[model samples]
Target: MIAPARIRIFVDFWNFSLSLRREDDAFMLDWKPVAGVMVAEASQLLGAPVIYEAMHVYGSYDPAKPADGKFRNWFTTWLDKLPGVHTVMLERQKKRNHITCPQCHGEVKDCPHCHADLRGTEEKGIDTRMATDLVSLAWSNAYDVAIIVSSDRDFVPVADFLQSKGIKVIHAAFPPAGSQLSQRCWGNFNVINLMDKFRR
Candidate 1:
């Protein structure tokens, strides 16, 4: 009997979550079943049975923000508990913006309009981490197929590289957004249509 294809899922958490919220804010994701769903869809496209290996979810939280702390808790205490699911939480790097006051032509330290702190956090190294894992895992012969669950076009190069190595990369795409990445991938499935199945 032929061995089933091993599938690994990689998710860019913020990109996936924000996109989902844009489509339907009320939708709550049930994470555990996600691997099964992707595997089933990919199996049909590959014309072969695939087994779920694991899912690696990458996210970032602002260390200075209370709301982010709550999010971190949910990520570490809750999401990390799910079987076969691994989570990597990174600290967001503060953004440095030098805003010049139009009236005085001097650097504005705070928001001139709302008087709020102009500094904010931005995700750094998350994409690099995801890309590294994708390649390293493939090199390790960890999985036969990879299902990338983000619309980030930055993944296009990695997808191309993986395909060159005889590994199939499936893009779990949001229609019309990830066309570039999808086109480079071996296969793609519309994640929007499957959103309902992930709702809590």
Candidate 2:
């Protein structure tokens, strides 16, 4: 008998979460069964059974933000407990956002309305980390298929590189948003249409 295809899932946590929130802000998700759902869909697409290897989730939290602390706690305490799920949480880098005055081209140091500092945190290294893992794991022959659960177009090149190496990379896509990413992958499924399956 032929061996089942080994499947690994890579998720951009913020991208996936924000997209879901945009679709329905009130919906809660049970993330444990998400890997199963993706595997089932990939199996159907491939016309073969699949063995779920793991799900790697990448995200960042701002150290100075209170709200981010809560998110970080939930991510580590809850999501990290799920079977076959691995979470990589990075600290967001503080950045001073430069706002140019349209008339004089001067940098605005504070918000005009509330006089708040124009300093914010920017997410760095998460995408690059995810991309590196995708390629490195493929190089190691970790899995036969990879499912990327994000709408970010930055992964398009990674998708191309994997396909060239004869690895099947599937995109868990949100329509009209990740259309370019979908086009680059070996196969894609609309995550929005399957949202009900992941509801908590």
Top-lDDT candidate index: 2
TM-score of 2: 0.93
- Give the candidate number with the greatest TM-score: 2
Candidate 2 wrong stretches, greater than 4 Å: 111-116
lDDT per residue for candidate 1 within 1-200, as digits (tens), equals 99999999999999989888888988798887787888889999999888889999999999888999999999998998887888999999977766667899887678769998877779999999999999999999999999999999999999999999999999999888889999999999998899878788
The local distance difference test score of each candidate is 0.91, 0.92
Clashes of each: 0, 0
Runs in model 1 lying further than 4 Å from the true structure: 99-107, 111-116
Please list the Cα RMSD from the true structure of every candidate, rounded to 1 decimal place. 2.2, 1.8
Give every collision pair in model 1.
none
TM-score of each: 0.92, 0.93
Please write out the lDDT profile of model 2 over residues 20-41, one tens digit for every residue.
8889999788897899999999
Considering summed lDDT, which 10 consecutive residues are worst modelled in model 2? Answer: 93-102
